[model samples]
Target: MPPNPDLRQTIDVAPGLDLAATLGPLRLGVSDPCWRVEASGPWWWATRTPAGPLTVHLVPGAGVVGVEAWGEGVEWLPRHLGRLLGLDADGPPAARTELVRALAQRVPGFRVAGHGRVADAAIDGICRRGVSAFEAARSWLLMVEAMGDDAPGPGGLRLPPAPRRVASCDPYELHVMGLEQGRADEVRRVASHASRLEAGTHDGGAEAIAHLAGIAGIGTDAVEHARAVALGDPDAVPVLDAHRTAAVVRALWTGAGADDTVDVRSLLEPHRPERGLLVRLIALVEAADAADDDGGLTP
Candidate 1:
């Protein structure tokens, strides 16, 4: 694909913003082919959009993010860069405790990335229910490898299968990809109604969440996750994961066992609009600590 010079643009970013740190959590894992982070250069992302297949190279400058794109969806990237970089965030909330203050200071560059793709977030959230992270990632990788198309860029990337295609897939085919029958059906249900969901996401606010939650197989948990990732609702608290809950509690309460639903909300309330980003950062820190304990092998 030839680069679209006319589509390229740069937007100013806040100081101390580490582009990698800001966007790293968006990847399913280190080996996620759709989102690539270079060791010393621009980040590459490939996705299927309403316009068409898009590949973007995001280069970070001293106080800006340079975006270059190719393909039919070229205009989407530049227009949505602010959401992607969490530019609208109110930053750290007033820290009521030293722990909260330290967390904010330690990862000042952290930001919640908004992909603005409801189908993608919905599919991911569905696959993750009642499963380990490894299992969810594996299932997603298998489905993408089986049904996705080649991306319009280098690195042999592939875009996730379009919602219509997923909506049409047979449950048996998805079952072969390691999804349970129930989950497979849920995926199909969400995909079949993806257009409506996407439209609702554009409308934004509680209506979108309500519309998504009203769908069969989608619960509050999935809605929360989708809101955070697809809609860029920084206040969206994800469904409770034991590890993530434990991590947060340990960070704040030292010897606490784990965070209950109410406890988690209370802990994050101080951060307000940046709560989702902060939660993700705490998870990242916990994952790093686990890696260290396992002698650098990620759990």
Candidate 2:
């Protein structure tokens, strides 16, 4: 049968943009339960909006990101397309320092993609706390598989459970999914207040972070990560892990050690609002180098 009719829209974008580089950070993995990316092709994302479940497929062409969506929230994706792709970001402010300039050159077209929903970002942030990226991704995939619903597409995808659904989950069940009791509780707390959190996505996320930080297990780092990923707060810097800290130190400060108490903000002062984007680019460059050294293996 021909593909079922679906609500769709195409958005023309600037030429030379790497859709993958712009959107890849949002995908947890190739087999991520919430999103799927066809190698060098389209990106499919599944989520539960306030209206209902939705699946959006993003395809990049000569100068556009084509969007095909299905389900009750089809219009929601297009409504926030600009924010999702960072179309409004005024590229990096003129790079002042040599380090910032070089780093910018290394990762061109790298945009900070936003989730457009504070609840989604908050849940991802909660899962990522005090864990390796691999572990965090695993927890996310497992939790979604256990709690999410089948997506409304041909890709055999799944939509993450609505916050209300997750909020109502039994802690013991979540514990079985490898979430410790504390983290599970944190997830529930955020989910229970998901509506309030969703409203906080506006105003650049200061309100969202403040609201979430009040909950146990959600800290400054988690709040920052959520703000950057969900609210598109250009200045939000994610809490870095040991390896990332070392990488930043080596890349920016020639002889600085990881324990040198480096003032990260000062290093990127010239790039104030774009600091988060700059940081992600540096991390991308580091990841690329490591991949090359490991014979193109990727984590």
Candidate 3:
């Protein structure tokens, strides 16, 4: 395979960036790259970087998968992993709609084109097990640094852990990284089968979700999220997320009680295969609102 590209960049997010407020909803940081959902200028974006301004972009065919970008480092993150950032891997119809629509609205000029690695997606699921986005990201940062490949960049940040690494981690060690005993055990269990998954055993995103649910601590929501990130299951909607659920409620019924729209199955009815798109639309709307709070970008 051809070597990956150099996608690292160095744009600054001006002065009005809010770490917690902007990324409070989704668990972006719960994996190797450590994602942070952000918005800059007219575009609401999500990224993974320790510092610098956010700049989301799309790059095709890097390494064995596509690359996605965000942050100054994106001007320069090796091309291999960068392309995965904006990956819109095939998923259920509903999921595709949600991701596409969300990206269109949030990332302006964004396009879903590229392949992503299954291994990265699996690790992302483990880090996100039953926690807030911040919690997941923090945990992921710790895990990736603790056990991952040496990243080929200035900071020396490690690449995400390999499948065997995840499978081999002892339960005790996992707890140290904030994972409960059961959750830790689940990570190891899933890791053992990571190779099988890496082989592309599952048929569709639904099959992938089913496999994820078979692992411990992973339910429908976790399964869906993992599929989206790992298997590129566009139709996989993270129905279990609080913000997504709340957004769905608001979109369907402006003044309705939150409880009225809590049913994920129903909320996704209209979009069918593109259920995730509805949630993403709501999420973009919310992200855009927050970005507007500071009188838009300084530019």
Cα RMSD to native, each candidate?
3.5, 3.0, 9.1
What candidate 1 gets wrong by more than 4 Å, as runs, is 1-6, 90-99, 199-207, 239-242, 252-275, 287-299
Output the lDDT of residue 230, model 2.
77
At residue 11, give the lDDT of candidate 1.
80
lDDT of 3 by residue, 1-299 (tens): 42233453333231333223223223343243533222332212233332333334322222222233434545423432322333222221223454445444454423222123343455566566667656766777777677765544333235555557777877777788888886677667766765444313234334544565676554455556666554434356643435555566666653444465366577567666655545554665576777688677421
For model 3 the TM-score comes to: 0.61
- Tens-digit per-residue lDDT, 211-264, candidate 1: 778987766677888887777776687654566676776665534453453376
lDDT of 1 at 78: 61
Per-residue lDDT tens digits of candidate 2, residues 1-299? Answer: 53663787788777666777777666554557887878777888888776677888888888788888888877566656776777756564355556667877776766666777777777777777777767777888888887788988776789875677789989997787668998899888888887777533356556766777787666676677787777667677765655666666666664544546886667666677667767777888887788899999975
- By lDDT, rank the candidates, best first: 2, 1, 3
lDDT of each: 0.71, 0.73, 0.48
Candidates 1 and 2, the one with greater TM-score: 2
Worst 10 residues of 3 by lDDT: 58-67
What's the best-to-worst order under TM-score? 2, 1, 3
Residue 209, candidate 2: Cα error in Å is: 4.5
Residue pairs clashing, model 2 = none
- Lowest-sum lDDT 10-residue window in model 2: 197-206
Give the C-alpha lDDT of model 1: 0.71
